[model samples]
Each structure stands twice: as structure tokens, then as C-alpha cells.
Target chain A: MFEKLARMDRRIIYAVVFLSLSIPLIWPIGLGVTVGPETKELYNTVESLAPGSAVILSMDTSPGGYGELASGAAALLNHLSRQGIRVIGMGFFDTGPSLLETAFGGSDFKNKQYGTDYVNLGYLAGSETAIARMAKDIPGSFPRDYRGNLTPELPAMEGISSAQDVALVITISSGTPGVPEWIRQVGDPMGVPIATAIVAVNVPNMTPYMQSGQLSGMIPSMKGAAGYESLMGTSGLGIRGMDAQSISHLTILALVLLGNVVYLGTKSGASRGGGR
Target chain B: MRRELPVALAFAVGVLMIVSFFFTSEPLVEAAKTVQNWGVIIAAFALGLASVNLIQIHARRIIRGKGLDWLYSGALIFSMIGIALLGIVRGPTHRTYQFWFDALFVPGQATVYAMTGFFIASAAYRAFRVRNLDAAILLLSAAVLMLGNVPIGEKIWSQFPVIGDWLMNIPNLAGQRGMLIGAGIGGIASGLRVLLGIEKSYLGGSSS
Candidate 1:
């Protein structure tokens, strides 16, 4: 029995995980989610932004990260749109601008006027250096908006000459040229508050920044997205996906525990047989 | 002159950048900005170079007529050109371009990422065995963390979140900080080597 359990086919595990993740999506358990302090801080920071204040939304992730971060970005964008904050979108990664468009198009901001409530400055070529240049001169860094409009004349970009003018900077990041780059190049030097909606793998590394106050707030991952959705009184993908995440974690944990138990039992039995 | 000129340029630019950080003089700052701008231009060129290199390697594979390899190479080249042309001519915001990205590229990337969960589960089942005391502790901590991040964890035991947060805040933070500090020191050392022309690896040659 122990041998059979130990040698279970990997395909079975994959099927089990697929079912564990899928069933929850089809019929959610609707488990309660406790909002973490960091997520709350992020919510409060954006909430405190005065109406019409300009904020920099740097989409620094590719599609792989977008899968994990899209819900969080959507919830945050919804909150921002509701609060009447003007957003200036930009991307470090080449793929970021399109993802930003997709996120914005799906949000409550659909009715929001382009070039007035929000505008995409599109992708800049340089990574960290581009960020530094933008901090110094936003107009110089991006001469034209993603849609080919002159950035200097855009309504959303009015009076936003540099990073300092923005009320806050939020980086939805997956990798390098991301939160750390923003913090080093703009946030610290310009005295602007920085926040992030980062993928799950980055949560631990970024926690120290939150603790030290370099980051004003953070949405840790999809879980953070769900918490933000709950805060906003909306049911989005984040909330819908949490059931699967919960079940998947439990399944992995059970597999680990069962594997250990089998190993221990086999070892003990082998010892008794050797003694006989 | 090839090696000498490149080394001299790197040393001069590296020193100027470091000096500008400490001084507020306009000329030094301006020089630093110019160098940074040059860096950006070079990086852009490098990207073009990489694309050219990709095209060369794959085109060669097709020329060699290596069975399914040629097919894959053909597909890659076709996709690359198709996407680039679509973006350049019609713009990224065009309906057709957006549809390709949304329906095809995004799902392809998401599928690749989603597969990791299954792989991780399989790996955990096969590899997470208690062979020693340290292994037991590691397994226990992993279990705690896995459970704590999920809603079911708190449902099973409210303490899961509390313990998980404690583990992350205390031990995890300490370890991360140590790594950051160590990396910072190593970076400074590497920068110095490059600035002094002691590290010629960046110039496509060994230090020795």
C-alpha cells in the first residue's frame, strides 16, 4: 500500500490539481478573506488621493505576470476611477502598454475620457535609465503618447512635468525594472510615495520595503486582489479564483503529508523486518 | 586600439557617473545624463542586434532543412514578422493586433504559467521527504507557509496566518536582508573592477 501510494503516477496528481482548481471556479466555496495590513495601506493611500490628482501607473509586467496581477490592477483601477483620480499610464516592458490598455478597457474606466482621465505614454526603450529620465523630465522621456498624441498637450499630463508632480506612483510589476527600479530612480529621489500590485513570488522580497516605509502600500498577489475586491464591494476574478487557490494549496499540503507518512511507515516496517 | 579605446571609454564614463552622484555641479550632472542617454541608445541597438541574431540562427536552421526543426523555425520567424509588421503599420491599439494579443499571446503565456502549479505539486510530492532533522523543519515550515497563504488555512486554524506572518517577518526578513546586503557589497566590488578596467569580461575578454 505504501509502495503504491509512493509511486502514484504524476499524471494523476496533475488531474487531481486540475479538478481541485476547476471545481472551485464552477462552484465557489465563498470563503472569507482577511485583508492584510499592506493591502489596506495601499487602499488607503489611493483613497486619500484628492480628486483630479495625477498618479503614475507603471505597467511593468508581461502577459505571464498579467495573469496573476490583472485582477488586482482592475480592482485598483476601479477604485481610482471611482475616486476621480487622473492616471498617466506608462510601461517599461514593451508588452506593458497593451496589457495596460486591456486592464483599463475592462475596468469601470470604460466611460472615462481618454487623454483627460487617463492616457498611456507607451513603452520607453531604456529600463532604469528611462525611469530616471522620466523623473527628471516626463515630456522629454516620452515625446508622444501611445496613441501618437503629443504628451505635452495631453489633458491627463497637464502640469505633470516630472515624477514629483504626481500624487503617487504605482508599479504593477513582475520582475526587474520594476518596483526596485521605480523606488531607486523616482520614488526616493522625487519624494513621491510608491506602491505596487506585485505577483505572489515577489511578496516576500517586497515585504521589507513595506516595513521600512519605502513602499507606502502593496497588493501582495491575487490573494491581495481578492481582499481589495472585498474592500471595494465588488466580485471580480480575484474573489472568484480564491476558492481554487485555497483548494489547490490544501491538495498540495495533503500530498506532502501523505508522502511523508508513507516514507516513515516504509522505513519502520523495513527496520522490523531486518530485526526479525 | 580596439580593446584600449573601449576600456578607456568605460573607465571614464564609470568614474564620471560615480562622481556626479556625489557632486551637484551642473556640468557633471549634464555629462552624466548624456552618458545615460548614450547607454539607452546602445541598449536599443543591442536589442536590434539580438533580433538580427535570432533571425540568422533560425534562418540557418531552415536552410539546413532539419525536419520538424525547420517547421518550428519557420513558425517563429513568421510570428515575429507578423507581430512586428502589424504593430508598426496598424499600431498596437488596432483591433486586429489587440485581438491576436488578447486571444492568442495572452492565453499562451498564461497556459505556460498555469502549468507551473501542477509541476510544483508533483515536485513537492516527490521531493519533500523527511530525511533528517533539518529536512523535517523545512518541510514543516513549507507546510505552514502553504496553508497560511490560502483561505482554507485560516479556516482550519486561525493561527496559521499568525504563525506564517511571524515566520515571514522574522526569519524570512532577516535572511532577505542578509542577501541584499551581501549582494550590495558584491555589486560595489564588481563596479569598482569594471571602472578600474580590471573586469574586461564586459568587453568580451577575460580579466587576466
Candidate 2:
């Protein structure tokens, strides 16, 4: 049975992996998570925003990354809203508009009327070029709100136009034309402090901007989400996801170790048994 | 002529777009803006075309009696067409369209993204083989970072988080900054090449 199982097909391995993931998700083990510096920087950057300061929330993620970052995005929005900052939400990704609604609807943020306390600019087609044009003229790029009303007519956007009008810019993104575009086109020229929450894969690329002070800070993936959750003192998906992430990580580590050991053992045993 | 004229236009406009960056004249800027607007409209149409292509392929598969998963593809095409119709004809303000988007589109994306939690674990398992000295170091650092990112490691040993933070802040920053500088230089160089027509990758594939 052991020998037969040892030679089990890759599908079985996949099944095991799936079970390893699903079991933890079904019954999670709560592991206390410490907030790292990147997250700390993200928290502090938001905390430091002055009331009435206009901050552009570039919710540039597809719907898929929403589950991982939505709660953190919400907490960040709620924090900004509480501070009395005017939040302008824009999406580069096509699915961004719905994501904005998801993030906003989940909290007290819904009470904040659109085109007043906050505005959703919805999806703009061009990726990086849109950010570039936006830096040149905000209304010229996004002439109307998501609802098709003239943007300038909105009380929220009355004084808000261009990157210069924004005090701080936070880009919640899953990919490119996000933080980099913000840093180059918007944050740097306008002197608006910029921060980002990127998918984990993109974090390495974003760190340089943060270091150079181009991006004031960043939240890197789920771990960054966890850190933001910790700071907000409201446990959400980031915290819950952290539990599943930890268990799954541990399981992988253990499996790798076991696989290596078994391989080495089999090699040495075969050599000895064959009269080495 | 179907592909050639558009391809020529794309090449011409693409060149003008690059050229407009250098010259500050009103005509140049206007040309650039026009090019950009055209790009946007074309890109949007391309997205629609891509989706229609998917619907065609998937619907055909279903029609040919492929498999159980063919139903999944049917669901995809149905939802896509429904949403596209809603977005185009009925408008976003309509309650039925909003309901479909909010309920179906939003959750569908979120569910797919949530799968990353599982995928990341599988990837990490494959990554930690420690095949060489470099691999060993990378594995060790990953472990330190993982432990540092979580609080239990700090409770067990405070140094773990501190070391992890240092690795991320110092070495990670150094490496990333180096890449950024290299990238900036490359980007500018490539832009110059494109402007010179020495590089035509942006013009896209050959017109054949």
C-alpha cells in the first residue's frame, strides 16, 4: 500500500493539495499576524492625510483580486471618509467600477453620497496613457461621472480637477499602469503623495518607487492586507485569509521536506540494497 | 486591403504619436490627442471583439456536444452577452442589469481571485526545492520573511521579524531600485529607438 501510494499519480497529488487548501479554509487556525513595515507605511500614509484633502483612490484591480484586497480597501476608504477627506474613485481595469461599489457598499461608506462625499469615475480605457492624460487635464480625460453626469457639475468634483488637486493618491491595483503610472504622471509632478496596494507578485517592482519617495508607501498583497487590518483594529478578510495562508504555507513546506527526504532515502536505500 | 490600410494607419498614427511627445506645437498635441482617442476606441472594440470570439468558440463547442464543462462555457457566453446588452442598450442605471452585474459579475471575479490563496501555496511548494546554494538562500529568506510577516514568529522569537524586515527594506529595496534605474534607462532608450523607427514592435506584428 505504501509502495503503491508512493507511486500515486499527479492527480492524487493535486487532490491532496486541494484538500490541504480546502480543509484550512473550512476550519481555519487563527495565527496572530504581525504588521510589517510596508503595511505600517501604508497605514501611516493614510493616517497622515489631512481632513478635506482630496485623495484619489485608483481602484485599478479586476474583480478577482477584490476578495483579497476589498476589505482592506474598504477600511482604508472608511478611514479616509472618517477623516473628512474627499475621495475620488477611479478604475483603470474595466471591472473596477463594480469593485468600487463592493468596497464602498460593505461599510458605512454607502451613506456618503456619490458626486458629493465621494465620486466614482468608473473605468477609463487606456491604461497608462489615461493616467498621463489625467495629469494634463482631469475633466478632459473623464468628462463625466460613472452615471454619465458631467463631472464638473458634481459638488465633489467642483474643486477637484487634475493630479494637482489631489493631496494624496492611493492606487489599489493588481497589475501595471497602476503605481508606476501614478508615480510618474500624477504623484511626482503634482507633488501629491502616492501610495499603493499591489498584488504580491508586483510588490518587488513597486518597492523602488517607495524607496525613492515616489510612492510614499505600499501594501503588498494579503500580508499587506493583514497589516492594514491590524492597524484598523477591524479583523476582516485579510486577517481570515492570513490564517488559511499560514496553514497552506506550512503544509507546503512540510510536503517539500517530506518529498526531499523520501527521495534521498529511496536513492540511498537502492544503492545499499544493490550492493554499493 | 482589409488589413493593409488599417495596418498602415496604425503604423502612421503610432509614429505620429511618438513624434508628438517631442514637439510642443498645438497641431502636434492635437494629433497626439486624436491618435490617443482613436487608440481608446479601437481598444474598446477589440475587447468586444475578443469576447464575441469567445462566445463563438464556446457556443460551437457546446453545440458539438463537447463535455459537461461545455455548460460552463455556455454560462460564460450567456452572462457575457446579457451583460454586454445591458451595458449597451439598457444602460447601467437599469435595475435588472445592475442586479446581474452586482450579483454575478462581481462575485465571479472575487471567487477567481480568491483561488490565488490556493495557487500561491502550490507555487510555494514547488519553489522550496533548494536545488542549489542560491535556492537554499532564497528558501531560507522566504521562510524568514513568512515567519516575520506573521505574529506567532515574533512571539516565539522577536529577531525573526526584525531580520525579515531588514531583508525586505534593505536588500529588497536595493535590488528593486537597481531594477528601476535599469528600467528607466531601457524605457527611454526604447522610446528613442521607436521614434527613430529602429524598433517597430509597437507597430505590432507584420502586415502579411
Q: Pick by TM-score: which candidate is best?
A: 1
As for candidate 2, its interface RMSD to one decimal place is: 3.2
By summed lDDT, which 10 consecutive residues of candidate 2 chain A come out lowest? A1-10
- Error in Å for residue A224 of model 2: 2.2
**Which digits, one per residue and each the tens of the lDDT, describe model 1 over residues A1-276?**
887888899999999999999999999999978788899999999999999999999999999999999999999999999999999999989889999899999998889999999999998878998787677778877899998999999989889888999999999999989988898877777789999999999988987788789999999888999999999999999999999999999999888888889888888888998999
True contacts kept of each: 0.66, 0.39
How far does residue B65 in candidate 2 sit from its true spot (Å)? 6.0
Candidate with top DockQ is: 1
Could you tell me which residue pairs clash in candidate 2? A34-B151
Q: Against the correct fold, how does model 2 do in TM-score?
A: 0.85
State candidate 1's TM-score.
0.97
Worst 10 residues of 1 chain A by lDDT: A132-141
How would you encode candidate 2's per-residue C-alpha lDDT over B45-127 as one tens digit per residue? 88878887988899888888776868888888777777878777976646787677678777876777766655655455444
